[model samples]
Target: MQVIDAMHKITSHIRNPSKFSKASKLALQLIEAGSVKPGTVSHFFAILEAAMSSPGACNEPSVRADYQALFNAAQGVTECFNQQQKKQFDIWVLHAVVANDLFTDDSFVFSKAVGKIKDAISALPITTVDDDNDEAAALAAVESKSGTTHNNTDDNAQAAASNSLPDDSTHAAASNSREESSDPFGLDGLLEHKSNKSEKAREKTVAALNRKADEDESKRFLKSQREALLKCLEIAARRYRIPWTQTAIDIFAKHAYDNMNRFTMQQRDAITKLWNSIKEQQIRRKQGKSVSGKLDVNAFEYLQEKYSHEKISIRHAVGGGGERRATQWLG
Candidate 1:
């Protein structure tokens, strides 16, 4: 059977205590013989789990005994292998132990095992083999005790070329000298500085002109839509029985001011009609009729419904009649 299959069988048998003796014997023999592959480290932990879960298992004394036996078997196999093979084996065993959550407290044992493996590998003679050649013999000996082939001549030339570049400190000093010689009072420097200043001034002037043009266009638009928006506000306010205060007129003016071009000609006409109704409602409220505030519930509800379709909230309408408060209503 494949190694992973064997490991699974062993783990299963160990978890079921009736099969513990058979499984434990097989697992111990396989591990001791160093037949487990590095890729099967995960499977090794499965076996460990089974062993730890068996009936009468994980009792401190019994667990410690089993651990010692396993440790000894791994050490024996490690000693019998060549250095490279032994390192691979040790790595697999260490991975298995750690994966199983064993050897967490007793780090000394792991440290000693690592030290022995390192020493064994270090003692092996270095071989000279070029991996880039890729012949069958070289491939077979790839894992043999050997250091990589070194090309000193090419490395030396690369090192010299790297060292030949100017360092940052020297470059900075040279740049400073060039700057000082070009302009003493730095008037050329001052002109260079003023060039940017003039450019920024030009940009600011252009921005101001554009803003003024936009403001004039906005004024014309508001003048055009003024009657319509006021009419709409009046009608909406009166329909909801809300009073038309100066505050209400101001809110309508602000909406006209900000959104002059946004409304259709029809919408503008509707707004003028609404505002006239608001004026009538105000007259009624002043005459002691029971009317709501300047912003009627219906007007608020309309704005809310309209903006909701655009994902805008109506919270801004609470005290301000749905108009942004930063700017004057007509301005």
Candidate 2:
């Protein structure tokens, strides 16, 4: 997966150098008070950030898929979410996380503890953001619902009162009356619903087309960032006359991509980790270390495992056809 590209929209929104520093502070407080794992906190942030702007983002299937994918891709660090944390995630994420736990219902005290958080998420934003088409749609919806609906409701109530239907009737008659009132021309209901469905579908297709250009731009931006990081790694290896294969570069490139944000801090961290790996591999070569150390494998795998405490390993081998192969440890 191209991690950098996937995260560009979210990371750009955070707009800060430090990786979720504000959210991390809140998460630490939760950890000290509650008993969920540290990884859970990161998962919470990811769900919240996505939920802020994505429909069905908090749904069980979508949330679970994202959780699993990110856990595997991050090697359990939740690095992507960490890089893209926003202040908005602090409340919505906390509510979602706590609400997911079964133990929250264990006691009355737990009820009071999460009561406020629950209320906070209840009034979730209908549209947290959209720069163009989404914003236009939202505004149109608000105008349609708020402005015209109010006048229509007033007229409908007066008309209903003036033309009150007979109440004394059979139960079957009352049922038929209710159904007729709802449908009016009967086929009017069917046609209205069909038209509504078609309109919504058309709007969605148009919106998707509108977003395609922006998506392309984001991919280009991420590609540039990826190339820049890869070039830095190339320069570092060349300085020491090390053989940095394109395959190995692709491996470490992904790792660096995963942890990177547009922030200066993330860039700095990548460089530090890259340099440390370079130096470590040199020492390993000088000492004629383990099989992993002797081979021209990925430096990122070693760097992340040692410094970040992620459970990770990368294995390189020769295929039956003499092509290079590597096993990736996901989750």
Candidate 3:
């Protein structure tokens, strides 16, 4: 995967660069605390900064795919948490890492811890954010209910007492009856409580609608990002000869497209295996096992057959071409 493009895709959802910076700082703190591996921290900073501050150097080119992918998911999830949640989340992560005995394999420990952190954060309820629309609607509703209820109650009481009796004693009795009938069983209190509940319900509905809109918009944004990244990868692979074959590039590119979020380290492992499969053959050939040091015929044929499709070259696929020509070398 193209590191820069992948970083952009992973972090594109972040509106404020400060949020990303804050997330990176939290990860850095985790690193310092020894909750996770130190190997990937520098890579994290490099790739993260490069993603955030575009045109910035990705100093650590040696960063592994697992680190890149995990950090991306972590950042996205962490950004969802509010300030208090984030602080709690950080503590939980540190604790989880220190107490983690489940993954004794060591090889998969970091990923497991990250997964645990994500699950924990996901379980926490999202804090409701109030907006002006919800507040205004609630205020308007409560005010309308109170105003109409008070005026109607007063008018009904006045009319009931006046229509009942003209004698002083009877008028006093009618007035007492009116008061009792108006809210005989504390219905006034009940009505006010119910009005409050209705206000709350309206607020909740508004919040839910806003949340849904945000989620839909985020999905659309990520979808567009994946499509654009896929197109760019395809264009790059078609015109120029990449170190890896078209099949490998296509496989990963399609994956990046399909799975825009939640990239797994396993995918990276698979790519490495493919790279090694081809690279090993090239090494063998250079050691006099074959004639060429550039391409391994056996490995190429095996992979091409395994991922069979009609190959299209850039020249025939499009009218024009990129200026850079392919130079044969191991990527």
Candidate 4:
């Protein structure tokens, strides 16, 4: 169910899949809204089943077929979560399915699969919804902050309505009377003017639209960055013949973000650099076991040849009392 577990099972079912190529294909499938169109939970499960059943370590044609199918399915699952605004849900569902041992459980449903997040959301402290009093209080607080007095608008209209008018401007009094009489809340009857309804509605509409656009843009940008990071991780996984879970990739992403100006650099560069450093550390650890008071270069080359497919050549020339021993490694 965890990302790593999914990755392992997936990797085991494919033979040398081109993860970078798959990433490119999946990236293009992203819609203009910036995510893959979501699939139903049933469809997602079906894809998972296909991927799990696919053959691994097959002939070239079979490998490509398996890769394409699995890649498509994986991409589908990723997009399913994303388009639905469920970031990281692909990995979450994988982990959940695994943890619940639901692969063989025919009775499990999608709602149950997704209920964990629902519980978390319900538990959040900010999720407070109550009766109409709370809504009224919220509205009142916002309205109070506008700084315009209720009397400023309708009160003036009322005053105008009551006043004596010269013959030339009789229409102005009539217009004020119509406006005051048209007040739906009857605040004007009390000689109090509320804000302009049409103007306030227009402002609210514009503000809401702007806020939604901003939210969408921010989500798109974040998704793009995360996709790029995931692409790098996938490439690394395939290249090194290693499996990665989401948690592991997340840790890598965290380190990469911390060190690379919060992922402003190309993600592949971080992946490559980190991979090399890790390999160097592993080599050093391995080399640590082979060290003794060593002087027999010929014997060392012999051992290297014996242990590896590649030949190691170490030449010793009788010069300066046969102390000159040169070593060269060839692949």
Candidate 5:
């Protein structure tokens, strides 16, 4: 019989074993004796069913005996095949076994067996078409070229600068207020006597306050930008079927965090303008009509220019920008 026809028969026997008990028994004998050819569908299916099925009262000892017999029969057939073909056959058998529901109840034992089968296949030195080593190597190359070494020095400097600025501003403001309060004379006399000195002090204090506000705003803007970048990374990962790993997420997060200050003023402004344009375009895209030609320009390019100075990775360049990356953790 043809391999496909024989496989169909074997599958029918497995699905309704009691109805084909006599024929199954005879087929089992033929398989165990190695009288049937290797790679015949019936031979493989009979072994697969015996391996997966529960050993009931009438079938228990007979099935066990048949299993050992088939194993012995397979030894000669396996010895005749090349190492690559053997590995391929082993994987094919494993896939079939995994797909069968009969082994689900015996998962622990079956899982261990599957592991052993994989280990044996791995030892065969045959490279499969879908091996992941290439992708892993590519990612490693990108990481090396990206130059994302974390340095605590930059963080410490920023923190020290942040802490010192606020204290200095508060002290200067307090001193000025106290001096102004000490002047007890009414309007004109006090104003003319202290006007020049007070104006100089006020100017210094305002400059300090402006400096502190700029620092605070920059910090906040960096945080918001980082959050948006992460959201975009997650969406790209999902679209590409990449498995989410905590280590990968943290690596990307650290890269984003460390490089936050590298954004140029122009890039930041471009990003803001891009987001504004996106809101307008989204309304048009949803309404099923084109908007102004300016809004029709590449939104991605706009985001790239906005975030380009921040050294964002290609992985984070999707899902309406960084917002998608930030929210992926929730799901």
Candidate 6:
């Protein structure tokens, strides 16, 4: 009943029908049986089924009918959801896309399929809930830090009452009450003195806003950096004939974050270094016939361990081979 699992099975069936026919059939049965509630799950089931039944390789001319079916199903799914839901659904679709290596087919049709899904996702308006929450939290934090009270109902009600005063007598009475409240010696007025406190509060509030702005800028920069790194990694993987997995991607993301400044400043050099290490690992892996052949996983784990221990070796790339206790060297 898991939509992603179904997607994986469907795409696997498309890739190797004979090997995965049972898995694909079971997945379709679970999805089509109505055991799961109808909305998003059903829509995804339709898309999966369409992909499963596709006639030819995604890049081939014979696959047009199958492509059309998938495209129509995706379109229908996109049309049924709001901006937020569509974005979520689009992410799920991307997971399916990556899980099946759909876009790695080196075909315009496969890439176009991905592009269509992205276009559908991009058509939706962006949600501001997180931004709004961040701002609200910043304001609240400043207020708390400044020991400022946010409750203004009484002050607002008082202003409203003054504005609603009907006659001169009522206005005079309100004025007297205001005068009494303004008296420095009065119990309420003692806390109402407009001194440097207001200026200090304003300064703190401004500082908080400035800090929030800086944080947002940092986030944007980090996002761009990560995207660049990921794009470069994907291209490098394709070039090296390596199959990347979600776990590998996650590891790369963490490594990129750890070395954000270096990666951002010299992306090519950084990626080249990382890729060289991976290539070395793959070369080492090929020597042993009994070795597990999950090259990407092994490479990723090697990088993860190397970086985590601050003992990475780039000398292997330059034919300088010596290892420290912390550095794991390939034989």
- Weakest ten-residue segment in model 4 by summed lDDT: 310-319
Which clashing pairs does model 2 show? none
Q: Which is superior by TM-score, 1 or 3? A: 3
Model 3: how far residue 166 lies from native, Å: 43
Tens digit of per-residue lDDT, candidate 2, span 1-331: 2332333334343223233334333333333444224434443444334333331132243243332233222333333333223222332333234323212223443343234333432332222223233324433545455433422432354335324422223434645655667665566556557545754654554445335433433332332233223333433233233233323333443444344433133233544565465556656667987324222225433332222221111011112222211111000
Off by over 4 Å in 4: 1-197, 241-259, 264-331
Better lDDT candidate (2, 5): 5
Q: TM-score for every candidate vs. truth?
A: 0.22, 0.22, 0.26, 0.24, 0.21, 0.28
lDDT for each of the candidates?
0.42, 0.35, 0.35, 0.33, 0.38, 0.38
Tell me the tens digit of each residue's lDDT in model 5 across 1-331.
5644654566456534453444455555555666556456334544444433431211232333343343444545665443333433343333232222123234354344434433432333222222234223423444465423222323344445444433444546755776667555655455445654654555565455445444433343333333233233322222221222222323332333233233333223433444455456447657988644242224334433332233322112212321212222111
Q: What's the residue-level lDDT of 2 in candidate 2?
A: 32
lDDT of 3: 0.35
The stretch of ten residues in a row with the least summed lDDT in candidate 6 is: 322-331
Backbone clashes under 3 angstroms, per model: 18, 0, 0, 7, 7, 0
lDDT per residue as tens, model 3, 111-187: 34334433433333322232223323433545455423422432354345334323335435654665567565666
Best by the lDDT measure: 1
Q: What ranking emerges by TM-score with the best candidate at the front?
A: 6, 3, 4, 1, 2, 5
Give the runs in model 6 whose Cα sits over 4 Å from its true position.
1-106, 109-178, 181-200, 206-210, 213-270, 277-331
Task: Say which candidate scores most in TM-score.
Answer: 6
lDDT of 1 by residue, 157-220 (tens): 3335335423445545655765677565656655557555654654554455445434433332
lDDT of 1: 0.42
Task: Give model 6's TM-score versus the native structure.
Answer: 0.28
